[model samples]
Target: MSDLNPRETVQDALYRAARDLEARGVGYAMRDARRLMTHALGIASDRLTLFLREPLPAEAAGVFTAFCERRAAREPVSRIVEGRLFFGRWFKVTPEVLDPRPETEVLIDQALRFQFGSFLDIGTGSGCIAVTLLAERARANAFVTDISERALKIAEENALAHSVSERARFATSDWFSDVVGQFDLIVSNPPYIRPSEMETLEPEVLKGDPHIALTDFVDGLTGYRQIAAHAEKHLVPGGRVLVEIGPDEAQEVVQLFTDAGLTNCTVYQDFDRRDRVVEAFSTKPSKIG
Candidate 1:
């Protein structure tokens, strides 16, 4: 069914992969096709154009076809590639952890605005949040928690990859149950999707992501409530919390933060101007403040 010949040029092979993906309605088919092709060929993406006329090695072409088949079946390219770019750095990804999302980078942006001696990340899937913080704020150490030990291990691997392993500690716990430190900045991109909403996510998303990382399987407010209730107790005075949230859940979540005694609550929008992050100051003002 492919237009590829027995000895097709790299471009022809790549084009055929894209065409096949497009036919299957794979969103971002062309881009993913190129990624799959380059990764399969073990070549740099920028080198793709240069190899257009070169015949793809038979082995590489076969690998490309397999990757294309997986893509057509709707596996996320990031998951298939086992890595994703978050906060401008690549973090290893796996089915055990959540594939880091670009929108969640807002947590990094907002947290960087304040100075913190220590950081806490709840549900630190893949360690993207915790490791990136430690990498950026060289002076800060982090305590990251996850309910899934498997996910915590993935986060630990990513922390090592980002060279933040020395500054990060990963724990398996339900929320803050076993967390031991007080932190100046507590952040999370928790499971905020509601149960019913889970069924509506894109097929690729549902397939490539861990269900535990995707939804609370509740009204989506469960994580918010627990974080709000416990985060304040674990924060250093005047500490701040910046949480990624469902766009429409801002008002309720803000109230939960307020109820937990976090002050100066503010909701921030993503680049698209949808409410994406909520920030609040702990009730006890620090001497440093």
Candidate 2:
């Protein structure tokens, strides 16, 4: 950056980056700037404070500048970097997979509250839910499906990374079309952001994320509709379905579950107290009967 030089101390470098990001309207500018600088420096974030007064090596400074430019250009901090932490673990992220949000962890929490054996994760981007669940349950088996092959690959890598690959199965399926057997637990964080809603989302948040993973291209409910219509066929008797819901979507998603004959539908909120997860149990037997 014209405003920063290699001879600058790490402290000054961070200051300049944070100021630049803040000037560009990043709400968490200081935090992101520090993280980016640390990433570029190849140093632990916790170590930054220890080395604040140290001058940046020319190579490190240039790398930091490039990363700063990417951030300034509206690239998501997660995507610009390597991976994101979810459920206490790091999952590799890419444009092919939707960046895992803290909100989706609500789905994991809700799913874990119930007992299950065979689990199915629809649109299992990054395999965070399935892999994490299998790791937690230890005895559970997972069958994960994603429409995007690239997304499935990343999920598989995540499963392997989490050491749950032995119990996890990956496939390319649209909704439940290719799912054969029933599962005691079915979960999804389906695309619910309506096309109309996209314009309202920050461009940087959407960058490097697949468009199909963001919107149904119809009403945002298309994916939910497919899930509602097909979930009954794949859920075993007494099985549970947990899907992460967008804000203001709990009522509609609950109705869809009820319409599909999944009973005891309930919406659960995240730590932010916003409706984030929807849970429904199968009182009726799997249609596979």
Q: What is the C-alpha RMSD of each candidate to the true structure, in Å?
A: 2.2, 1.5
C-alpha lDDT of all candidate models, in order: 0.87, 0.86
The true-structure Cα RMSD of candidate 2 reads 1.5
Write the residue-wise lDDT of candidate 2 on 1-289 in tens digits.
4547858998889888888888877768888988888888887778889888999878888888888888888888888886888999989998888888898888887777777889989998888888889988989998999999999999999988888999987889988778888999889988889889998888876776888988898887877788788887888888888888888898999998898888898889998999988888888855686
Across 1-289, the per-residue lDDT of candidate 1 in tens digits comes to: 3535658998888778787888898988889988888888888788889988999888888788888888899999988888888888989999999999888888889998878889889999898999988999998999889999999999999888888898887789898889886788899998888998987899888999998887888899998999888876788888889999998999999999998788999999998999999999886754233
lDDT of 2 at 165: 95
Q: How far is candidate 1 from the true structure (C-alpha RMSD, Å)?
A: 2.2
Which regions of candidate 1 are displaced past 4 Å? 1-4, 285-289
Q: Could you tally the backbone clashes for each prediction?
A: 0, 0
